[model samples]
Target chain A: MKELTILSGKGGAGKTSVAASIASVAQNAVLCDDDVDAADLHLIFKPEVKEVHRFEGGQVAVIDEEKCTNCGICWSYCRFDAIHTKAGSGFYINAYQCEGCRLCERVCPSKAIHSYRNNNNYWFVSDSRFGPFVHAKMGAGEDNSGKLVATVRQKAREIATETNAEFIINDGPPGIGCPAISSISGVDAVLLVVEPTRSGLHDAQRLVSLTNSFNVPVYGFINKYDINLQVSETIEAFLNKNHIPLLGRWNFDVNIVKAMLEKMSVVEFAPEGETAREVKKVWEQLKSLMLTD
Target chain B: MKTLITSTTSTPEGPFDKRFGRAAWFCVLDEKTGESTFIKNENAEGQSGIGTKTAEKVVELGVGKVISGDFGPKAKKLLDKFGVQMVIINEDLKVIDIINRIKG
Candidate 1:
């Protein structure tokens, strides 16, 4: 199967919109939203969850006060400064400050401190209008975003193989951080969407560097290229310098927003529109390029 | 009794380093003998766990006090357990100036 990912180093650069549009056009595909931090592609796909699984994050240490010994070893050994004394209360762990290293629990002389896994994260396997979908939602301040993303992708690959799907398309998270790295690992190709703002160009440069370092093939396109044509040209020059192929550019259009509000991909809402036509053409070209390779 | 001061360089003339973890030098001052020695900080450029490393060094050296601009939560916790005193100096000054102030 051909595995493709949609990523933009900068947020609000149409990664989701482009991924959703491609999802509508691709046949025999399984979709995964690797943005567990804020998985929103499912909003457009509206997946009916077929399977649900809990994701266990890092371990957090908790101390029991009734154990009768205030040896302070746990307090001394806590590298995160998670242990705090509250007036009358002897000690408590500040969940926010804790890195879940489990050092405190091990150093506790009274065996009062015990570490527990953070299981407040969940991932889903479901069916949407476009195809089979895999996505996840993690609690605030929960660690292990990269691991969660890997889990979702693994499940997506399983469903893709079982159904004999031709493509596994993923909507990746923003920035060249952990989640983004996890999304593109071992993928066949990456679709990089860039906006035409100064900040957009700057972040896109970072993403391009990251992708190239991983030696992953990248196909780029500019979203809202008409808003800043000068920036668009500069982006084009940059992509040319980097030897990354520019697939196509989409004009700044409000119809994308209108289509989203109507809960439809641009392809589904306005298949005959100029933006939709360009997207269709790009997907076809991208698919052919993958097949030939 | 010994005190540790975060410094920018391994010399008395160098300025004090406000950050404890990334300091380039650690100055150990003997209150009784009025002798000071500077030690290079190997963890100055470390990306993570610098606080823990610095604090562990302070504990191993058996310093009674630490003077720096700020201390991270992790370093502070370890130092507090070891019963080491902490002093924060926000003003930009030379290492010599701080040593003089301690002597005065």
Candidate 2:
């Protein structure tokens, strides 16, 4: 099955809205939300969770005060200042600050530092109106978002292959960070939903370069293109100059927000509106490209 | 004891920089000897984990205290683990002034 990931180099560029609309339009597809850090597609898909799995991220060090000989060796050797001493409490490890590198655990003369994996992160497989959906929720200050994104994508691919789904629709995270890299890696195609602003163009440029480095085929669409016609034109020119396909330019619409408030895709909310019509056209173009490739 | 102060420029007269990991310069001051040295932060423009790198550098320099406007989670954690004291100053003072305040 062909895997299509929708991404935005910068947040609030309407990436989720576009992904949700595509999910509504596509038939026989498995949906995956790879933006584990701030997943909001569930706000629209409202997936009824079918399976839940714990994500054990990296280790975090905990100091045992009772075994204490406060020789200050752990403090001297710890690369991260995660261990601190309170007046009454000897020494403690700050869970929030610890990277779990285990360096302190190795150097502790009293053997007071204990390391353990954090089980706070989790991912889920669920049934949505669109299709089988895979997503994850990251714990506050949790690391390994890229790993979580990879896990959900793998699960979605398995479901897609088993069910013989035609496509895998992924809603990717913002920026060219680790999670974003994990989302686009080895995907069939990338659809970049960019805004028409200076920073939008700048970030999209960076994202396009990143995708190019991965040797992935990328297409561009300017969400709310009419907001800044000049920047939109510039973005279009940039895409053209980079030899990337310009799929569609969607106009700014208040109805899109109204649709989101009702937890509905724009196409589902207003089938006859220009926003819905443009979205459908983009999906159609994307399908043809996927099939041709 | 050595105190590390984040600064915008290499000179002590330069304004203190609030950002710990991405600060342009780090001023290392010897509290007892009253000598100061400035080192350009090589990880200032790093894309990721610059906080951890800066914290490691601080430890390598044997700094007892860190003065900055703010520290990222990783830097704060690493510093805390190494028994380094973190001091947050909201005022826009020069590096020299902060050192003077620490001295007093």
Best by TM-score: 2
TM-score of chain A of each: 0.95, 0.96
Over 4 Å off in model 1, which ranges? Answer: B1-104
Put down candidate 2 lDDT per residue, A84-143, tens digits, no spaces. 888875777888888777998898878888899889988999999999999988788886
The sequence of per-residue lDDT tens digits that candidate 1 reaches over residues A63-145 is 88888277677788888788988687578888888888888887877889888878898899999989999988877897535
Across B9-34, the per-residue lDDT of candidate 2 in tens digits comes to 89999878755766779999999998
DockQ of 2: 0.01
iRMS of each prediction in angstroms? 17.5, 16.5
Return the lDDT, model 1, position B33.
Answer: 99
Cα-based lDDT at residue A93, candidate 2 = 80
- lDDT of every model, 2 decimals: 0.83, 0.85
